[model samples]
Target: MVLVTGGTGFLGSTLIKILVDQGTAVRAIKREHAVIPDALVSSSLVQWVDADITDYFALSAIFTDVTQVYHCAAKISYQPADHAAMLHVNIEGTKHMVNLCLEHAARLVHVSSIASLGVSKNGELITEDSKWDDGADNSKYAVSKYESEMEVWRAIMEGLDAVIVNPSVIMGVGSGSKGSGVIFNMVQKGLQIYPPGTVGIVDVEDVAQLMVMLMNKPEISGERYILNSENMSNKELLDRISKLLGKPSPTIEAKPFMLGIAWRAAKLVSLIKRERPSLTREAALAAASKLAYSNKKIVDATGYLFKPVDRTLEETSRLF
Candidate 1:
């Protein structure tokens, strides 16, 4: 039996659908009162359990008879106010999940983010061997994910079989203007300013497929793979989305100083409205930083090809 955490999330729900379609008996854990996605609501093969990963006793009860585990649950936030929750859910929760996997002797497939990986020192493509610099200008979310990954490594040292995948920005349809879909929605609404930075991107399907491939290959254990289809500037990505959505492309470039003002204004607006800010200081910095990731290791290991980013945007545009 296979168990999946964060089953209601975008990537987790997609992964569960694939697993169930493959005739796998899957059990998924979700937070109490979490709404199940429509895509996963009709799956008879999935047994849903409401449990929080941070609660060890409650989470451990659902691990019975589980042979494989996919750790897909994570909290993502760039706001300073969300630091505590992000650390609790991403780091402490992962520690508990790692401990449960160790006790159950279950093979683990951990879904990490490229945020945990290091920035390229020489402006080259970032690979698995890139050293994470804790002192560098890193986001709180990155710090949380990095520490969470350390927990998985600790478990590995104690004889738990596992593999990790660090995926770039995952994009897909049906996200309803949340997560990565926010970018698509911004373009559709004629966002005029584009950040002058580049980033790696991948399809959500590619990430899910790669996770399943890594889980089935025991010989590939004890290593982390970087999954990225292509690296492109934010302007290029937004331009593509605009064209696909039949909207005007972003012509104004948002420089660092401009972004600083924008983020501050957004924060003030959020405070008044009692809503999360769409732009945070950390997110603004990330948008202005150029980063690229290499998928050579995963490609060579599995000989798997990724869907082109433009094509993914084209397909996802229909959903808007």
Candidate 2:
């Protein structure tokens, strides 16, 4: 049996669909009260359970008869207030997964993020082998992912069969104004400021596809793969999405000082409304960082080609 965590999320649900299509029986777990995506609601091949990854007792029971595991559940946030929660979910929760997978002898496909990777010290492209700098000015989310991956590596040395994939900004449909879908929504609603950073992007389907392919290859365990497809400036990405939606591209390039003011104003507004800030200081800083990722390892390992970011944007835009 195949077990999947975060089955209700964007990438997890997409992975479940592919497994169901291949006639693979899957046992998927979601957080208590998390809504089941419509695409997964009616599938006989899928068995949905309500459980928390951080709750080891609840998660351990679901590992019964699970021969393959996909650990896609994670908490992603850049806010300082979310730091503690992110550590519990992303780090402690992964510790449970590594332990449970070891007990069950189930091969694991851990879904890590490019956020966990280190900065290229010599102005070269960041690869799977890049060293993570402990003293870098990392965000809370990056710290969580980095610590979580450490749990996986620790387990691997103890004999757990696992492979990690670090995907760049994942773009696709079904996110409904959350995740990267928010970028499309922002562009459509007349956003007029572009960040001065370049980001790597990949299609959600490609990420899901690669996860399944890796899970089936037990011989390739204990390796990490970067899943990025393209590297482009934030301005270029926004322009393409805007053109697809027939909206005018952003004209103003937001510098660091401007971002500081914007995030502070947004934070004050959020305080008044008792809601999370739409812009945070960490996010503002990240928007201005220029980084790139290399996907040569994954491409050579599986010979799998990623769909163009343009095609992914066009499809996701139509759904938006």
TM-score (C-alpha) between model 2 and the true structure: 0.97
What TM-score would every model get versus the actual structure? 0.97, 0.97
| lDDT, candidate 2, at 299 | 90
Once fitted onto the true fold, the runs of candidate 2 whose alpha carbons sit more than 4 angstroms away are: 271-274
| CA lDDT of every candidate | 0.91, 0.93
- Residue 120 of model 2 has an lDDT of 75
Among the numbered candidates, top lDDT falls to 2
Q: What's the lDDT for residue 203 in model 2?
A: 93
Count residue pairs with overlapping backbones in model 2. 0
For residues 1-320, what per-residue lDDT tens digits would candidate 1 score against the true structure?
Answer: 89999999989998998898889989999988998988778888989999888899998889899989999999998978889999999998999988988999999999889999967776888999999997899999999999999999999999989999999999986566789999887887779999998989999989999999999998988899999999999999998889888999999999999999999999999999999997899999899988999999999999998998888898899998
Worst 10 residues of 1 by lDDT: 172-181
lDDT, candidate 2, residue 291? 93
